[model samples]
Target chain A: MVKATPLAIDIHNLSLWYGDFQALFEVDLQVKQGLITALIGPSGCGKSTLLRAVNRINERLGDYVRTTGEIHVLDQDILRNDIELAQLRRHVGMVFQRPNPLPLSVRDNVLFAHRIHRADEKFNRRKEDEIVEHALRRVLLWDEVKDHLGREATGLSLEEQQKLCIARLLPIKPTVILMDEPTSALDPKGTAALEELIWELHGDYTILIVTHNMAQAKRASEETAFMLLGRMVEHGLTEQVFLAPREKETADYIEGRYG
Target chain B: MLTERVQLSTSIDLDHRGRDWYTDKAVTFLVFVGGISAIVLIIGIFVFITKEGLGFIAGSLDVREFFGSLAWRPTSPTKPTYGILGLIAGTASVTGLAMVVSVPFSLGAAIFIGEFATGRLRETLKVLVELLAAIPSVVWGFIGLSLLNPLIIDIFDVPVGLGVLNSGIILGLMAAPIMTTIAEDALKAVPDTYREAAEAMGATKWQVIFRVVLPAGRNGLVAAVLLGVGRGFGETMAVLMATGNSIKIPTSPFDSVTALTATIAAELGDAPVGSDHYRALFTLGILLFVVTFIINLTADLVVRRAGRK
Candidate 1:
């Protein structure tokens, strides 16, 4: 038997509806292991919705929602009813558009994931310090926040807060991280910094990011998927997708003709 | 050309004189009236309370005996004791008890209504809580007398239904709705971003409520507690009916007691004119006024701090 490299996420023939309105139609894609893939689209193109569907976070929105499809994460069907949301979410962490740190000390925000998900009380002061230090260091936020770990997280700058959120996600050791327009609210310098961090993190984790900036998609991703009107118009290597798009719509969007 | 320019300038001046001047004056006058009315009302009420309370503070009347003595029997001629210590202690005990009973249940209900329930269920629970607030205190008192008092007495094997326990329970029910409603509003005012952040970190629903939502709305929660305390302190009919109108300090939940508002309401109609008893009732009124003032001031400070944040 010929063996195939297993994909991290596989979505096959997925359709989603919010009551009478259909949002996505027969979307198919694959996320490769340990690489950064960017989903680029205009506003209202269902990019964020599709990202939310991978972790089943959309199911918590309301009862009127209906989804017909199969989504697989780590070779396990995640759309099944028996799939535990908490466990799935623990493995698939997310960062939102705006930086939303808890109204707590910086240290607590970093350790929140472990405290909530891990039931072990035996991790004393030394282990806790190690975990906090490692998580913050991974996101390059340890030195800036080390002295004021006891200070409130809300008092940080927007860039620092977003990085703190990333640090928070790291403590859970998620297999994949989903970012929805992570730098849309940031300044140019902040955006460049976060882009660098995303590239650095691509070595160890699968990253699926939704961004409207074509340059950012081109810069940070190994693979890029272009979506328009809730449909995936093109999916290929980042270089090929930008230079030689298969569809005219993808080329036009990348060329800034029409969203 | 010069004549044309002068004519155009004159028309512009006429337009401004016709509409702008009158509208601006009317708006300014209306604002002045509204602002002055509010200030006057506040100052007037303060003046009234202070005028009545000054006699008790002045040395012309004995302050030590009035505040320190135990007995509150005003009609006894031989050794009439008009101490406010017992009444003040009684009021504090009842108010404290009412808060203890109401705070937890009201907060739980608020969290459930605001964060946990589905759309229709949340609407239904909210309607019920609003109805609870709308029910008159006198009606609550009647319910306590006819229904709750008997039940409590039977369950606890007490001699009478009217006691500290009965008043506290009734006041708790009366205050719970306000606490729940205010707290729900506070919880709802917390931005969804905070909740989403917590949930994204794989936090359980309960943990999100306790860790993220509650802390984000701490100032509002404190305001709600203060509002509930005010409601419990000023509650008159229910406390009067269920407390057995006792003047002694309450030693336990089963003992009969009286609160400041209850004392004023129960004795004001029969208090003799220009007598020490009348002055003492005014004094009770002063105490109630001070309590409400302090609670509202604290609430204002908390709200301001939250706004600054």
Candidate 2:
């Protein structure tokens, strides 16, 4: 008997429209368990839209955002009405394009989602400290921010702030993390540092990162999905897709032609 | 060629002296005058009030009695006393009650307008609130006299309905629309990014607003409430009619009271131009100016602190 591979996120024929402007059309993608999956495309190519679709946050932009799609995260169909958004979000955390640490203390920003999910639980300060420490350490930010836990999170540099943003999601025990251009705002050094952090975090959580940088997509992810306009052109092992692209459009994009 | 180059260098005219430059200079001058006029007018008013009230403060006025004694019998026949303790108490009490009435309603309205209401409803509610603010103060006083008076009497079962309770409710209603407008602006000033961040964290809509938006907008809300309190303290005609214009320290909401603004509005016309009573009233005007200045300063400080954070 053949062994089956586990999938963390399975999206099927996903289509999204912001009012009358359709941004994504009939997109299909599979993110395997415990691996980094990078979605790369030109601007307005719906890569970020697809990442946001996994967490189902695009609908909150406005009621006019209409989506006809099936997005299943961790084998659960998130688009169905029976799913509780709060519960689904607890399992699937997201990092925005900008480093948006809450306007709170570093300790509170990490504790925020944990507190929300565990609202009914008895208060335990020791456990909370442990959670904060573990989450921060997982993002390799514990030593940098350990002495200044009470300081405001927004005051941190963009690189540290982005790390803190990812750190905040860890306490919730999220199974999947969707990142939208996680390093687009970082400097070259910051980007290299963050990529190191992502490499360190692999095999523990399934991460889906969208990036405009093709080099980053190739270097960081095990699997790479190329999108054009609103459709997924190709998705394969990162090395194979970048080295011997199956499609002519994929080859042209890789060669830095028209974005 | 060298002579041509020297001539070209000599003829270089870089100064912008066209009609646009003249227009810019004229506008800069006009705006400077316009801006300075406000400061000049404010200082001029302060100087005039101080000059008018100096005679009383320098001569026969007892500073202690003006603030300490409750006997505000300014027009007494034999021993005319100018004690304003009772008026101070009355004004403070009515303003306090007005704040009590206005804060919840205005904050709730602000939250609804800023967070919940959508599309046509939001615009409609905003326009309605502005319209409410535009209603004449005299009309509000009339509402207090004719509408609220009988209603309070029926509800509270009191012999007379016009008092602190009446004026407080009336002033509260008068202040509420403006407070809502300002509070909405404060909430609007909070970035949408914070709300998005909270929502993505699995916070329900209420949790997002209560935890993130409210905390981020705390200073603006406090400033809004302070501005509302300032308005309540300075209001005149509405309180004059609804307060029944009685000079006494109000121990209860039912007790009739007179406010400082109401006293001046009622008696300044009858008092002779340069009498001791006139100077006393101007002294009250000086006090009003200082209190309002302090309130405005506190609001500015709170808003500036928000900027620093």
Candidate 3:
């Protein structure tokens, strides 16, 4: 077996606690550059928490949280107190499970991210429109939303809202993208569309996804990590893990004996 | 045996009827009393103010002078006069000053408590604000009179602390609790999704508060401000104690003035019935009614619009 080289994000012995409730326990994982890694688990298994930890967004929970060990992103220690969470977040953008576009116009939602992440860039209305249009086009949403660019983003359909959210994140040009059950709230058609977009996005950005759907894990990622009760059950190439999981727990979970 | 059974059946039937019927009647009576009392009181007050003030408003009372005049004196036996311009000006000045003083601080505290403050600190700060709100208005008035009033007088001058400025400062102290609490509620009412969305785009905390949270809470904050303005405008004892209660237009924060509520409280006593002086006090009541009604109505409109979004 040939392992990948130069991990984009390296997590070492990471443990997390929300007050007395431990969420992640001594979990170690590596995500390679320009590839998708899926963290799959049953509900309450801390897949989302582990994904949030990679970008240090878990710190937003405040003092109730206690995290130990290190998270390295591009050879930099992301867990260090000195790390700028906002800047790190800009580099590692997130897309939530629900479609959460701003209250502003669709055009403004896309421009807002660009304005925040790239403040030094000159404020040109036309240039902003171009950037927004390009992002919308990248998500295959431009044809649907182009005429209604000035409409409130909340007015969009659920699928369009999710696509708009994706467009909003793209303008920042983040190197890594974290998604927490991105299509869990969508219908079959919307979910299929989002899956295709995720596949396309894999070549340009390192993606870390947390999902409860086993089929989605098989379809969307190259590597898979299975977790159970705050512990890593198995982690390996997607096909190998699904076909011949090394651990008994992994085998049981894959075979639908228990989660 | 038949007679005994019939007597027993009649007695049981009477007992059941009496108890159940009486209970239902008592409940209905109580609810009716409470509901009717509230509606009657509200309508009664409105009718009384409008009826008493209408005659004076219709006869010889110049609306322009009443609103725009610089002097307000409705207490002269020989040459009686009545004009609300000074009181109106005073109300505007005090409320404006209070809003200016309270708005920024209240918004900052709201954002801090709602967005930035974490865990125990957030809880502590919230408790402190609630305690501040719990303090009685008269107690606040007394504190302002004894402590804040004198402190300002000594620091700035007697005139500066005993006028519109003093009234405004006292009202600001009173308004701060309402502003912070309501603003905090408004900020919290903004969905977590908005914050998450903003953060995901790498927006700073300040940027998120200003651009997203504040705008989203615009209507609620406006309602908060209107409520605060109503409280400031209608406050009697605090303004009466802090303001020197002079019936003159104030030039600056450093001059004494009388608000409509203060004027009515001070002069309603000893004004003979059916006199212009008496009627004018009722007219001041009318003015107060109009001001508060307008403010509350505007607040309702804003809140409705917010709900639509």
Candidate 4:
């Protein structure tokens, strides 16, 4: 008997509109459990919009954004009217294009999500220290930042700041992590470092990353989905999509025909 | 090629000698005058006040008697006491009470306008709050005199409409717009990413505001409150009309009192030109200036530090 793979994010017929402009069409995609899935697209192709939709971050754009259809992350339909945004966000963490660390201490930034989501839980200083240290260590940032945990997170370099952003998400114990061009702000070295970190984090958590860099999608992701305009044109194993792309558009995009 | 180079050089010279150059010079001259005028006015006022009041500062303005004694009788034939303790206390009480009334309400309004309200509602509420500042101080005093006096009388059964409480309420109303406007600007200046990050961290609206936004905007809020305090302390007309000018240390908010501004407004005209009373009023003016200067300096320091962080 063949084993069936459980899906982490099951998105179906999802459409999003900003005012009169439709940003996402009827799109369907299934991201597998404990795998790195990359969404590749040209500029203004709704890659970020689709990524934000999984965690419902696009709702913060205000009432102008309208959505129809369903996005089920870990079997929960997050697009439902009765959904609690805070609860939904706790299940899914996001890292933005820029390394947006709050103007707070490194320790405070790492503790932020935990404090918010688990407000009722009893907190001890020792436990919190462990959580911060563990999260930082997982992101390979513990040694460099341990001595200056009280220093403002913004004081860190962009590379370390991006790592801290990822580290901050771990304490929340999110089921899926979404990255909207997470390494776009970093230099080449930083990008390579962050990609390695993301690869290391695979299998423990489902990560859906959006990238404009085709090489990054090929180098890091297990599965790849290509989007054009507002539609998911193709999705399959990363090697198949990049090496022998099924669609001419995906082939052209990967071959650097147009960005 | 030679003709083109010559033309380019001539055009550059013409650009330097253009009408925009004259306009720039004119603007520079006007701004320079505007900047120097404030300093000149301060110097002029300082010289005038000190020249008239110097003798009292030099001789009879005993620091102990001026500040320590409560009797403010300057017109008495036998004992012309110039003790301004009553005036200073009145100013402090009025300003302190005004801050008590204004701070929380203004902060609430600021937060509501800055964080809670949506597009049009936010803009409209901000404009309306700021419009409150445009209302003349005398008009506010008149409103308080006509509207609030009877209400206070009916509620508390106070003797007259005029007192520290009455003036403080009026002053608070006057200061609210300034506080709300500056504080709203401060809160709004907080980057949207902070809000997004907190929300994405599963924070509720109030939690984001109280924990993240307010902490980031603390310095601006402090500056706003200090500026409000300065406004309340230096206010003259509304306070003059509202607080019945009964020069004494007000034991309660209900008791009538005379602030330094009100004292100067009421007595300076009646006193002879160079009498000790005139000099005493000038001294009070100097005191008010120094106090306001210190408050403004503190506000500047706070704003600068906030920018650095």
Candidate 5:
């Protein structure tokens, strides 16, 4: 079954409502394995909502948010009621617009998920050090933070904080990562550094990102999906979607005629 | 460039010329007075209590006898004894018991109200718990007298129902509402971003609360518990009505005793005006004041530090 389908995430006819208001209407998307995909749209276009729904994080917003239809991650039906959130989330990680690192020491922040989900599992100092070093190095933060592993994660700069947030998710070995405009809070230098890092991890993990910057989508993603007013307007190869004239809405948005 | 030039040329002066200036100054003066009133009142109370309490301690009563000896016979004709050791022990034991009873339950209630409950249910639980705070201390005392007193006697098989145990239970219940409110506020004050981040990393509901929310709000939680301690320490009428008001150090929770606040409340009405007995009661007031002042000061420091973070 896994041989035939190379998709990491598949969504079908998904509709979401926030109380009386509908945020997403029959949105369908397919993210291939081992590639970076960007979802871009205006502020209220439900790009972030779509990203949140992939990992079911939107359920925490409140009970008023109602969702229907199916989301499958790595061929597992995640929308089913019996699906365990902890297990589902272990396979699908997320990064937010703001770098919300736990108010903990750098090492603890990296090991938080492993510590909680594997509560009964015992780890020696050597194993813990290996885990922290491996995860931090994956995000290229080990060099900057290795000397001060015991210091507070909140004390790091905004760029390092975002990288640490990404590193903290690595120990769980998630196959799919959903980023909700992860570099929005960083400066241009931080954004470029993070984009480079994301590019480096291009083929090892499937990444779906929500962004408002058209330039970021053009620069970073292999595939891009455009949404407007809770509908997926276009989905294609990043270059083709940007250059070729397809839908009028997509062209107008890409040409900067209107948001 | 055109817009910038227009904006620069058409800037409005915020410094109003006539009555508006006076209005701003008047409002500022009122706010200043309002802010300083609490400090002035506290200092006034300190001055009055210390002045009245200092006379007997300086002249007649030995410092050792006042603080060291446990015998508390203050009005005896032969030899008047005024050691407050017994009273201090009573207050300490009852406050300790109150903390033991209230902290766990109040924290549990706070977690439930802050994390688990939905909109209507959350609002309902909050209103109910806050209503617990609005219930008068005198009413709580009466409840202890009529309800808890009989229950205690039946359970422990004690001679009189009033004791450290009964008063401690009453004070704990009375303070739980306040503790829960403060703790819930602390828990809710943790930004939603932390919860989302933790949840996205596959943390279970309880794990997110215990590991992230609770630690982030630790200062507030400490402040809540300390404020509850202060409230328990300063509680007067409930302990007065429930504890047997005996002037002895209690060996067990079941034994009758008089808390410092109870001692002052119970004796202040009968003591003659401008007498040594009256002054000693004021001394007990000073002791209570100092302990609660220290507690409140620590709580303020914790809150301020948390704010800075």
Candidate 6:
């Protein structure tokens, strides 16, 4: 079922180790541009670990975590020693499982990433308002929060905060947005709202989401990749993988057997 | 198994107080005593100082003359005029200078320790800062008397080395370790997620610290600074030795002057019991107490505000 679409993310035999214990083993995942791809697995299956590797953010754990092989984003090798991490991160924004808006007003949180990356540019109030309004509108949170734009972002509801987290990344116009269980902390209603927002955002930005919920992977993503025991078991269309799995492990996991 | 269950049920008392209850009660009482002692001692000290100084305040002491005039001659033969305007100025000048010297130094050290250093180096620097805090004020005074005294004199070619400049620098150094400790704790209290989120947005390390962590910890940092100011205000022995104890208002950083704390420290001995001079010294004690109380209260309120947020 190969298509003519160019890949947004191309990973080649990626292996990672935290100190002595390896977390990922020669996993390769190619994510198509302008599509939502979900990585679903049981606990310790290294789904989240694989997502964190795309932007190399897991290295913040210091020199302990070592990575081998290459990760190229939009045809640029991100694993190069001389590459600027700030520039890389600006192009590849992240949304954490728990929504972490900085201790800033809603307006400022939306403008924070933009301001830092474009530090030399001078801006007036109208331009900043446009940027904040544009991003919040994309997340479908503009009308609800427009009146309280000066309110602290943390004071918002969990769903609104999560949407704001995604909005803050939008102003950067990231090539790929990586989300690690973006709905793990939300209630069922909030999760549904966020899934809808993600669906609404497709074709504008490439999305790679990691989730523990198999149903969410089926419901929200066009393509799904299942990992088991730190290895990618299968990658295919969501329907074919869930409805008719080829790998025995994927079939066993989807049917509620031992993980 | 059924018989054992019955026996275990028979020994269990649902409502009875056990060893855990008694231990909890003991700890509660101990904590209450520890907490209340500070309040009680503070009130007791305030009452004692007030009683000692109230007699002079109520009698011939003119409030305007006492606060307005620069004349601090409590021992003038026929007409003793007890004015502390000069002493207040001296203390204010010295403490102000100390804050100027210590605030940036302590804050920079705190940032370095909190955001930059790691592993053994961070641990070692923290231990050293705390050790610096433990050094006796008398030793700091001695350093001012010997080391800074000569250095200041050589630098400015002033006749008197023991003055506001010497003492201010000395007290600033003395207050720095405690300030650094408190400020570092404030920075540490900022959540790590804020830093992670900022870094994920392509912020440099300094940018993350400057924009996010520092602003999040603003209340704690303000409290640390106020605490440092209070420490400088109440410091007696070091200021007494290093400030030259010359009863006059200082016009510049190089002038010799005395602090309110230094005055009380120096004159309380020579003044006879219950004499006006003795009461006047106690009066200075009351002023110092009140000022320090306000400063400490402000600091506590700021920290509590941080807690609420």
Model number with the top DockQ: 6
Docking class of 2: medium
lDDT measured at residue A95 in model 1 versus the true structure, 0 to 100: 82
* Angstrom error at residue B199, model 1: 1.7
Residues A89-143 of candidate 5: C-alpha lDDT, one tens digit per residue? 8889999999999999999999998787776777778888999999999999999
User: What's every prediction's RMSD, in angstroms?
Assistant: 3.3, 3.3, 5.0, 3.0, 4.4, 2.7
The TM-scores of all predictions, comma-separated, are: 0.93, 0.94, 0.90, 0.94, 0.92, 0.95
Candidate 6 docking band: high
**lDDT per residue, candidate 6, B158-233, as tens digits?**
9889989989999998889999999999999999999999999899998999899999999999999999999999
Q: What value does the TM-score of chain B take for model 4?
A: 0.91
Q: Model 5: which residue pairs collide?
A: none
Clash totals for all candidate models: 0, 0, 0, 0, 0, 0
10 residues in a row with least lDDT, candidate 5 chain B: B1-10
Q: For residues A69-113, write the lDDT of model 1, one tens digit per residue.
A: 999999899999998777888889898898888889999999888
Best prediction by lDDT? 6
Model 4 segments more than 4 A misplaced: A1-3, B1-31
The CA-based lDDT of model 6 is what? 0.93
Give me the TM-scores for chain A across all models, comma-separated.
0.97, 0.97, 0.96, 0.98, 0.97, 0.97
Tens digit per residue, CA lDDT, model 3, B1-309: 365553345434444567779899999999999999999999999998878888788885877777777656566656655667778877788889988888877888888999888778999999999898778878867876788777887998564567777778888878888889988888888898898788767788888988898988999899888888888888888888888787777777878887889888887887777677778888889878888999989988987888788
What is the DockQ score, from 0 to 1, of model 2? 0.74
Off by over 4 Å in 2: A1-3, B1-31
**Best first by DockQ, ranked:** 6, 4, 2, 5, 1, 3
Higher-DockQ candidate of 2 and 3: 2
Off by over 4 Å in 6: A1-3, B1-39
